[model samples]
Target: MANKAVKVGLLGLGTVGGGVARLLMEKRAELSAYLGVDLQLARAVDLEPARAEELGLAPGVFSSDSWSILEDGDIDIVVETVGGLEPARAMVLTALNKGKGVVTANKALLASHGVEIFQTARQQGVGIAFEASVGGGIPLVRSLRDSLAANRVTSCLGILNGTCNFILSRMTAEGAPFDQVLAQAQEKGYAEADPTFDVEGTDTAHKLAIVASLVTGAQPRLDDIPTEGITKITPLDIQFAGEFGFKIKLLAVLNNQGGKVEARVHPALVPHDHLLASVEGPFNALHVNGDWVGQVLLYGQGAGRRPTASAVVGDVLELARDVAAGVPGRVPPLGTQASGGRRLDLAPLDDARCQYYCRFAALDQPGVLASVARELGSFNISIEKVTQKGRQEAGPVPIVMLTHEAREADLRGALKKIDALPEIVEPTVVIRMA
Candidate 1:
């Protein structure tokens, strides 16, 4: 059996899929040598027939039908890079039921339907490896599941989306507006044509839900997380953040409070000297705090063809080793066996307490500052620092304030009242402090 080849079928021939195929084909000899068995790319399935010619796959290996690989008894593992919900979800379930080990980079599928997926794998006695799902080549899932297994993880803060990070980084460095930097990002292929998922914080939220599920052993619904995008972030806010000794970043945060979890994604003002603040461009960083291990920072190129493909192949090799050894479920997919059944109590955002950076555009009139402050005071929100910019004789000016720790509900209440005042012209912008 040691001499037998562990066959793999790849679904999708897009950017990530092409990279996976190239890595498997190019590194075939080395991988087979390392695993002590032939790791072969048995089939590659895609809708476009031209992709097969483009990737230069072996004549019999490329097919338009996914079932050719899924139904093939010889194939031991199926790697799904076809993102989004519909067919990817259906294909993954079918692969697991067939008792074939699966490796995928579909974070959205996992985030939304992970419990069902994990349960299927467990019942089938086959493993599902997703090392590339979250932090690309950073080895985040394996680290959290294996390296930090002994510790009770208390918190995890991450710069999870590379597109958002890239846009924000350019905005900070060039002092450009969001639209300008986003346009540049699309031109450079750092963002998708429709960047809603990344910019709207849904992508980051998906990753956060996965990470939080690993920590809490319960999968939280994607809709439950309070997510705020960076589209509203302006150069003015970025400048104000810098003035306050901070940098603005789209952050995914998960805090385990006595078994209850707080999962949120938003633009947070991180301290200038912090590790996460320094992570610029398309890079991603995750700061995980464990009860026993304290704090650990993981940084790397979060997403790309090479980095993500490297992670996908790593999972393939790991599963290949198990397949060769005739041990399919050697390691639990989520590091622990309690994942599918455990329930996590997710705390609402209203209960969350944190410092805030608030910007109010109000008319340059006397009593404006006091009126805003009095509203905040009534709701038990206290300002630690305040600055007013652009003294206009007939127009609204920016009034920025940094407040001490306050409950989210109170802050929202205060802001609601403050915005209704006659002196206030535009809605207040509020960003939480990390």
Candidate 2:
């Protein structure tokens, strides 16, 4: 008997796809030795075959038609880096139905349709690997699913989006406004021309959903998670946070209390000495708290051709090893139970309890501070400390307060009444303290 070759096929020739192809070829001999099989790049599918030439791949190895890979019986694994929702989903599902393993970095597609996709893999008796879907090159997903498998994950907090982190870091460093920092991020290519997805917290929310599923066995509804962007963050808030020994970063947090889960994405005031606060620039860091393992922090480049591709290829090797072992679906898609029977209730953001940082632009009237305090008391929200400077400014004075731990609903109601006061000149800025 001879050792059969494990054939691989790629569905996209973009940055990540190119990197995967390059790494696969470069490390072919070592990977083959480790897996105990001849690993081959059977073929690659791309809309523009000319792009394949740039990667220095032979003509026969790259094809414009996707069917050549998806329908090929010899291709044991299908890697879908084409991204987007449509063709990626269709290709992955097709490959699984044909008894081929799948590896993907399409976070949007999985976050949206993961339940159905994972169930399909189970039905087909094949495994689906999505290591690159969250945290880029960092092995957060695998660690949570495998290494920390013994302990129960209590809470997950992360600066998941690098673009927003970079923008916020710049604002904190240079005392720049949101608009100015965003423009600088675009110039540096850290952010896209239209960075709404990354800046608005949608990208972080998607990654959180995937993380929540692995932490718990339930596939959460993406639309149900409360999300808030960093667009409203200003240098004033940054300065105030620094004064309070804190830094502001957009955070994707998931808490599993008993069986109830609370998932949200928003800008939070992290203590200056906290590990997450120290994670600056375009780098990402995820903090997971488990019963036995305690707190674990994984930090690295969150995205780019090389980092993302590294994760994608890591998944490929994992699935390849599974195929060789003859235990393809041994590990569940959600990393625990094959049947997602656990249905955890989603916690409403209004019910969450946390400290708050409040700022008000007031008319500097003697009773203005008293009025704000009284309004907050009306909602049963207590202030921990209040800072008001009596400078001889022409306009309204800035009144900043740090409130004790209070219900989110109560803070919202208090802010509504406070903003309605005649002395308040502009909208109140309220950031949650982590």
Model 1 residue 194 CA deviation (Å) reads 0.9
List clashing residue pairs in candidate 2: none
Clashing pairs in 1: none
lDDT of 1 by residue, 136-230 (tens): 99999988989999999988999999999999999999999999999999999999999999999999999998898788778898889999999
RMSD (CA, Å), each prediction? 1.3, 1.5
lDDT by residue for model 2 (1-434), tens:
12878899998988899999988988989889888988888899888866788888865799899988988889989999998899788898899899999999989998888887888888888989898899899988899889998989999889999999999999999999999999999999899998999999999999998898898877788898899999999998899889889999999988876747889999999998888999999999999899989999999989989999899988888888888888887788887764453444588999998899999999867899999999899988898988887656588899999999999999999999999999998999989887
Q: Estimate each model's TM-score.
A: 0.98, 0.97
Cα deviation of 252, candidate 1, in Å: 0.2
User: Of the candidates shown, which would achieve the greatest lDDT relative to the real structure?
Assistant: 1
